[model samples]
Target chain A: MTATDTHRTIEAIFRIERARLIARLVRMVRDVGLAEELAQDAFLTALSEWPRTGVPANPGAWLTATAKRRAIDLLRRDRMLARKHAEIGRDLSEEDDAGIAAIEAAMDDDVGDELLGLIFTACHPILSPDARVALTLRLIGGLTTDEIARAYLTSEATIAQRIVRAKKTLGKAGLSFEVPRGRERQERLSSVLEAVYLIFNEGYAATSGANLTRPALCAEAQRLGRILAGLAPDEPEVFGLLSLMEIQASRLAARIGPDGMPIPLTEQNRARWDRLLIRRGLSALERAEALGGADGPYALQAALAACHARANRVEATDWRRIAGLYDALRRVMPSPVVDLNRAVAHCMAFGPDAGLALLEELERNDDLRNYALLPAARGDFLLRAGCSAEAKLQFERAAALSRNEQERAFLLGRAKACSV
Target chain B: MRVMVFVKATEDSEAGVMPTTELFEAMGRFNEELIKAGVLLSGDGLKPSSQGKRVAFDGPSRTVIDGPFAETRELVAGYWVWEVKDIAEAVEWVKRCPNPMFGPSEIEIRPFYEMADFGDVVTPEIAEQFDRLREKTPAR
Candidate 1:
């Protein structure tokens, strides 16, 4: 391969192996911060040397070895302290090729699970929820702090500090580098799953950006969810999360038109939906129900998504079942967002008038005041009710409030169509 | 053992966006869990960096960095000092607390030194001063 290809290959390998590499290093050093720094140093070294020597056959192992050597060098440099130096020397001597091979093999064996553990660690409750999400994406998702900040429309400095402080807190607390257990595991797992779902939702329908959907983020979230499902095969929420992402992802191909504009669900070409994703989603949902975890917020959402997945057309969707699921979700996790969604379902199940009443009730709450979806949903209801003038006004308002380019364009199209 | 858990502050966190009702409810559930498990000593959110001041001592000269420090990442948002049996026990407790941020955030934990930990080199006077300082500061 050419030098450029070698560099690209290294980057790809790092993207896939970054979490595992850091996890293994953390295990050895017993310091998350130091482990990450070492991992970064290794990446820098690869950037400088990989091009000249060509990529190694086992790039992940090579990077680990390189990082370990650097760590040993640093330890040796601190040899002025006799006792500390000796400790370092002892560790280095003990970690011969055989030990290194064992560590590498162990890392490769449960990499997915280890990555999930790392995610839970990053999302630990000790950190602020924002820090948890930021750290998880940075460490487990292999995303840069800057990337995460941008994803959330925040400053890079804010994200950088959150990460630094998060690592420091973990270190200071001397938190163990392992997945939590029992009740603690269940709680932390919820946050981990929530973070993953948040990432997927942003990718599925970007809150704000030039593009409507960031397919890469969606794919990554789905990949992580699948890994989580495998690691915790009996956890219903895991399957629920996977089912939701899979079913939502199945519609990606049909959600955009030939010109790259947003396509309303009713307007989407059902033939273009990925049947494989739908199948995976249905299977995951079944697993979740079989595990008796059908009552969770995620599972309930997945069941609602299943209604759409089973439908051949938008009209064929079991809107009443979806409405019932939303009702359950509201009871479990009450929020204006859920009510808005329920309103949409009610419209389909009964009529636009019923949905409009629910929407109006939700509108009284200040939380949805700035939420663009309220007006967008209202506009849809109006359009169906043949109130073209009122619908046009709501659509225009929605178009004005929306930050997403695709969403704005979609709303504007709806407004223009009403005018016609 | 006295362990210090550092809660990294974010811009929103410092702004005193009084945890929303939902956030409080979530945190209350977590705190109840922590208290029930006997891991929580005391904790509270911090004021914005703009309201605080950092004094750096070098030799005899002290440099005071005003609140709203330019570096958000470097600021300490809040902290908790827990009396635990050991680091392992502290970790178990921290694992149960609710995340304080609405988005990605982190809390760091560090061990505090007791007079007994200082061996014979440290005098009682210094220990007294450390105790006084600990008293002046909030539990986090």
Candidate 2:
């Protein structure tokens, strides 16, 4: 392959394996920050060396081995050689075919668990929400701080500081790098699932970018969810999270028009949806339900997704079921967003008037003051209720508050249609 | 054993932005669970790093770093100290925490040393001073 091809190939590999690579390193060094640095160092080495030596057959393994070597070198430079060498010295010294085999064996054994530990550590509650998201995207999603900043519509300097502070906090607290267990496991699991969901959501919605969606982010989040499901198969919430992401991701192909404009779910082409992902999502939802997770927030959300999935057309969707699920979700974890969504379902199932009543209740909510969706939902209800004049005003207001260009355009279109 | 559960800082967190009421309620519920489980000794959130200072020692001189430190991987956002039977027991409790960042974040757990571990080297006077200092400080 040409040098450019090699570079692209390496970047692809790193993107795919970045989380696993960092996870393994964090396990070996017991430091998320250090592990990420070493992983980057290995990537840099690959960028320079692969052009000359050509890409290796097993690039992930090659990266792991190279990173391990770099870590050993770092330990030596830090003058902490004796301490680590004592633990694994004899294995490193064999040098011949036997040593190589032993080293490979050790690497293979250590890498998987370490990656899981890294995920758990990154999602730990000790870190601030911003720090957790920033660190996870960087280490697990394999995104650069600049890329993350762009994805989140934040400044690079801000993101950089968030990550640095996150690591420092972990180190200062002397947090261990390990998969939590027992009761603590249950607590941290939600955080882990949320982190993965946030990654997927950013990709699905592209918080702040010219593009409506970043397929790469979506893919990475789905992959992480799958890994989490595998690691915690018995956790209903894990399957629920996986189900939610997969089902949402299945609609990616239909979420955008040919002109790159946003396409609302009701207007999306069901035929274009990924059947395979829907199947996977249904299977995960089934697992979640079987594990007594029907009431969990994620499971409830997945069930809502399933309602859409089960429909042959927008009109056929079981809006009543979705509304019921939202009611259950509200009972468990109430929020204005959920209430807004519930209003949408109520509108579809009952009538626009019913939905408008709910929206009116939410109107007085201080939390919805800056939330664009409240007015947007209210406008939709008003339009459906034949109150075009009020609907037009609400749509105009929603258009003003919306950050997404496509969303703004769509809302403006609705406003114009209302005027007619 | 004295243990520290570290809460890492983030941009939103450093801004002194409090979690939404919904989040606070959820976290409060979770904290209640921790207390009921007998794993929580004391815990609280921290002010932004901009409000804090870090002092590093080089020989006899101390270099102080201001909040919103340049390196993110080195700041302390908040922490909790608990008395647990052992590290394994502590790990068991940490697993149950809700997602720290409903939007984006991480939490870290570290072990703290006890007076018994210091042995006879720490005099009663020094230990008393340490105890007094710890008592005056609030858990983060």
Question: Against the true two-chain complex, what DockQ does each candidate achieve?
Answer: 0.01, 0.01
Instruction: Tell me the tens digit of each residue's lDDT in model 2 across A258-355.
Output: 56766788888676565556877888899999999999999999999988877756777898898899889999988888899999999988999999
* Residue-pair clashes per candidate: 24, 33
The DockQ of predicted model 2 stands at: 0.01
- What DockQ does model 1 achieve? 0.01
Per-residue lDDT of A8 in model 2:
68
lDDT score for candidate 1 against the true structure = 0.76
* CAPRI quality of model 1: incorrect
lDDT for every model? 0.76, 0.76
Give the C-alpha miss distance for residue A81 in model 1, angstroms.
Answer: 2.7
- As a whole number from 0 to 100, the lDDT of residue A139 in candidate 1 is 79
Q: Positional deviation of B136 in candidate 1, in angstroms?
A: 72
